[model samples]
Every structure is written in structure tokens, then in C-alpha cells.
Target: MEPDNAERDPLPKTPDPLADWLEEPGSTAPGRSSWLPILAIVVCVALLSGAAYALVKLRKHPAPGSGLTAGQTALASPGSAWARDFPVSTKADLDGVCRGWYYPQSPAATGPAPHPITVTVLDNAFKMRLQPLSVHVPDGVKKQFRDAWQPADLAKVQIVACVDLVGSGKPLGKCSFTSPKVTTVPFVEGIYQITAYEVATGRKLTEARVIGAEECPLVALVPADDVLHSEVSDRQLYDKLHALVER
Candidate 1:
């Protein structure tokens, strides 16, 4: 007979519910509730990560139509209507020249519009080779005014022009220009598709597809300095725009 004080086999060891649940495979019942907190934490972490990534991307690359930076002006015109369509195009009169279009059938200026007209150059090309030419463009354009309107008219007239690469991704050839030194290391190539607009009326004044070599590209309109003058094709573009306004 066993002694009364003798310890009997510990009452069949009591099963621990937590231990059993942990051991079970895919136990959804009561155990599922425990996973809720962990799942929520994971989901929150993923959402936060996504939000941060988006914020960084936006800061790095500002979206289109957001606004302009310093030294930049708006490109769009007030009224969206085009003044008139100058469909007639011209080719390079001389060999080794670029070709394009200018508005106004006549070389003369229509008259004079309000001073301080805005001109926007839209560069729709893969590469931005026309940037430098854009800087000197105002001088050339102003010269066109003088020629069309006259030297006295230049004082009264003002031209504010800016260049913008709209990222058209257009594949084009080279656009060469003759300089004083000529055959220099510093040179730019590629076909540049440029569109000039009169910002006030939103008129599509002139479009140029310059190829091969040119005399001062569009800068030729300015006769000052030792730089070469623009070819007939290039000059016509500016002249035509002035003609539109002179009207």
C-alpha cells in the first residue's frame, strides 16, 4: 500500500493553453486575435514608408504647371487665340544653311503694338543646344523691329523673351552656326525645332527647323559685333513676326 504522505504522480500535468496554442499550426480561433496588433503595426510601417517616398520624389522633381523659378517668366499667352496662320514656308536661299518659316507675307512691319511685348521660345528637341542663341535672341528680334519699324521705333519697343525646353523628345540633326574664329572646339549640333509665340495674343508667330550650318542662327538679325548675320530663311522668321504685329 502506498504511504499517505507519498507524492502521487503529479496529477497528470495540467496542459498550458498558451503553450498548446503556440505549437498549433494556423490556429485561427482565439489565437488570431493576438496577431491583430502585430499585423496593424506592420501595415502602419508600410503606409508610412510609402508616404515618405512620395514626398521625396515630389520635392526632387516638381510637377509640370507648378510654377517658374527665379529669372523665369510664364510661357502661356493671356488670350489663347492665334493671331493668324502663316502657313507659307521658305527654304535656305544659300548652300549650307538652315531652313524655317516667318510670318507676315510682307517684310515691312504692320505698325507698332504696345511696348514690352513678351516672346517665348519653345525648344521642342531632345537636346538643349539653342539655349545660348536664346539669350541673344532678344537683340536680334529687337533689330528686326528696328528694320521693320525703324531705329527710332526700337526705343519705344521692348521685347522680353525666354527659352523653355518642353521636353518633346524630338530626335533631330545638327544645327551649326558660323562664328568669328570658326572651326572651334566649342560647337553645338542637332536639329533644333523652335516655336516663337506672342504671349499677349498667344499667336504662334514663327517656327524654325534649323539644319546644317547657319550664319549666327537667328542672331544674324543683329548686325552688331563680328558675328555673322542670319540667313534669309532665319531672318524671314523674325521679320514675319514683326509683320504680324505691325498689322
Candidate 2:
């Protein structure tokens, strides 16, 4: 047995091992170590946010001198509301009003004579009967339509069979002709695509349709007259016409 004086010397007052380890730069407390992962996450998130911002900025300014027209730009800028608001159709939408008329242009002193135009497109409702506008054509050539049809009747027809003028489906939206005499423009009528939009949302709503009879030439098949100013916008409709007369 040790003497009382030999009682175990007081244990040296050493620092806690855990506390010492924490004080070293190489070591960390459990709580503090957890903060490292959290901080790294925050940094990563900030970087991602910055990259997204840069991407958006790049879109706001397209490449300089891209040669994009205003219409093209309006279509290309999907980041803006205009793209959503003013969507254009790549196809001739059948959702709008359509009208068409055919007339003979009297052959000039030298040009090819126009005649015998074939009727291609007929309203799905009933094949519209084409009567010779001329009295010289025999009555036997007159074939009765299953249903009476008129320009006013186009609204009632649902589907319009459009055979492309070039035999290839292409937009024939504008028409102009020139001669030695004063230039005259005629309105070609058929299948005018009418696009309608929603007022509130600026969203395209439906394709409304307009059908009508175009003015015809007199019995002499006179030269086209100066189209009235009011009809100028409609001159663009010359493209939608399918020739019903083969000549």
C-alpha cells in the first residue's frame, strides 16, 4: 500500500482531446464540418444562377448583323411575348374565310389566247357547276350542279379543294401582270385564309372564312380595269385562285 503522501500525483490538467483536435486547422467540430458542405452547395447554386443569367442575356441580344428581318426577329425571339402573341402559320390554315372567281383575259394582238380553263377545286359540299358565261357556248355544255351554288354559298362549304397552280403546293399569295398598255390589276378570288386572334390573350383563335364572286368581264371580255383602291388589299388574294377554265 502506498503511503498517504505517495497518493497519486494530481493528473496533469491536459486539454480535452476533442477540443484540441478542433483547435487544429486540420480538424473540425462535427457541427463546423457540416457547414463546409452547406457552403459548397451555396457556391454551386450561385454559379448555376450566374450561368442561367448569362444565357438569358445572350438571347436578349441576338448576334449582331444576323440579317434577321423584323418579322423574322418577331418570330425568333421566343424569350419575348411577341413570339407567343404573333405566331405565324407555316401552312395555309383552313380556319379563315375563302373566296374565288375566274374570268377570261382577252388575248392581246400577239399573246396566247386564254380558253378552256379546267375546273379543279370544288367545294366538298357539292361540285359547283360551271356554266359558260358566254352565250355562244351551247346549252348542252351546261351541266347542272347537284346543288345551286353561288359566291354567297361559299360560306356554307366546309372544305375547299385547292390544287396548286404550279401543281406543287406553294403560296400563290400575290399577283401582278404588265402589258404595253396601262397596267391593270385584277382580283383573283378563292380560298382566302382568314386568321383571327383572341383579343384578351393575343392568342390566335380560329380561321374564319370569306367566300365571294369576283367581278367578271363583259361579254366582249374587256381588258381589266384599275382595281378600286378599296380592293388593293384583296389583290393579294390572286394567289389562292385555282383556274376553273382550261383555256
Candidate 3:
């Protein structure tokens, strides 16, 4: 008594075309490959971010003697940072008021090989009061001599450094001078340092013959042999001077 339609098996069910396409082997649906694109994008972003961070760090911490010395103070040297060591040292003369490597022991300078920089004086105490005088570096080797010197009120004054590329070792000492009102000079391009020390008066330095007569200090603009200067020319001293100035 079953109806023919009921008895007959339902016509083979038609497959959904969409379903067949989705279920088909080796078929690429829209979202199947989404993860790959996302992962690749993430990896590229990470690499770019890392490179950017590294570049920032390099700009923040420039190499020593660059625009900034190890101390973070700007350098007077025109180009990049540089340093040298002097093995031989000059003798300190006690006969005068003050003493140090004030003269270039080498020959005369025809050109500015070892540049002259003017170093301002500061008090030795932590107060670091300014001194009336400054140390002058000449482009040549001549030591300057004057007839008389005015007494500088400075005692136990902070030391200043003139870096000599050809000079070796730390300076043995510093000398003082008196000029009418040479409180400061417009900044010039060169290397410099400031160490601490106690020395007498300007007159003594002049009398001691520590400041060379009007002659160049080195053999040439630079020195051929071991010449004199100070260990203060090194990086540490460069940093200290900058700190003192900034503070």
C-alpha cells in the first residue's frame, strides 16, 4: 500500500555546489591562507621595529671625542675625536711660582699641526670659582716671556689641559700668566682638559721659566720624538672637564 513516490528512494540528493566546493580536496577557500599573511606581516613589523631602536641608541651615545668628549662636553676639535700618548715627560721647575708642562719641548711650528687652545682656570675647591687667568696654547712651539707679571689671586687653582696629538703622557704641571683683562676668549677649535692642582702665583710661574720664551714648544706642529704633556689628555679627563663645565 506504500505510495510509489514514498516507496521510490528519494531522487539522489543534489549536493550543494557551495558545500562541494568547500569540501573539495586541494581547494583554497578565502580564509584558509589568512594566518600566513598575518604572520608574515607581524614578522616584517618586528624586524623594522628592531632596526629603528638600534639606530636611536647609536645617535644618543656618540663615540668618544666626537662632537662630545667622553665627558659629554662638546669638543673644540674641528672634526672627529682623537687622542695620543707621550712617553717622555718634561721636568717641573720649582724655582718659579708655578710649574707644569707650559712649554713645547719640541721644535717650532710652521703650520697648525698641534693646535693651540685657550684653557680657562677654575678654583681647586669644589666651589670651583673662576680664576683670573687662562692658559694659552700657541699654534707654534714658542714659549712666551714677558718682562713682569701681575700676581694672580689664584691658589690651588683648578688645572687646565691642552691636548697635543704628538705629545706623550700626562702633563707634569701647569703654569700661570697675567693679562690685563683676558678673562675669556671666544671659543676656538682644539682639544683641552682640566685637572685639579695647587700652584702659587703668576709671578712665580713667569720667573720659573716654565712658560717658554716667545718660541714654539714642539719640534714641529707635532713632535718627532717623545714629548711632554699630561695623562689628562685621556678620555676620563675629557669627561671630568665637561661635567665641571656643565654642572
Which pairs clash inside model 1? 102-237, 103-240, 110-246, 110-247, 111-246, 173-190, 173-191, 174-190, 175-190, 220-230
lDDT tens digits by residue: candidate 1, 125-174:
33222322222223545554444322232222222223333222232333
- What TM-score, over all chains together, does every model reach? 0.26, 0.21, 0.20
Clashes of 3: 29
lDDT of model 2 at residue 111? Answer: 21
Query: What is each predicted model's overall lDDT from 0 to 1?
Result: 0.34, 0.30, 0.28
* Per-residue lDDT of candidate 3, residues 1-247 (tens digit): 7556755666688856466345566565675553565789999999999998975553332233223223332222322222211111211221111223211111111232222212333222232323223332223423321100111312212223322222123233432223442222221122233332212111111100012122222221122322322222223332333332222
Clashes of each: 10, 23, 29
RMSD in angstroms between candidate 1 and the native structure over all alpha carbons: 15.2
lDDT by residue (tens digit), candidate 2, 86-127: 221211221221122110111111123222111123222233
Error of 1 at 204 (Å): 4.3
Superposed by TM-score, candidate 2 places the C-alpha of residue 13 at a distance from the truth, in angstroms, of: 21
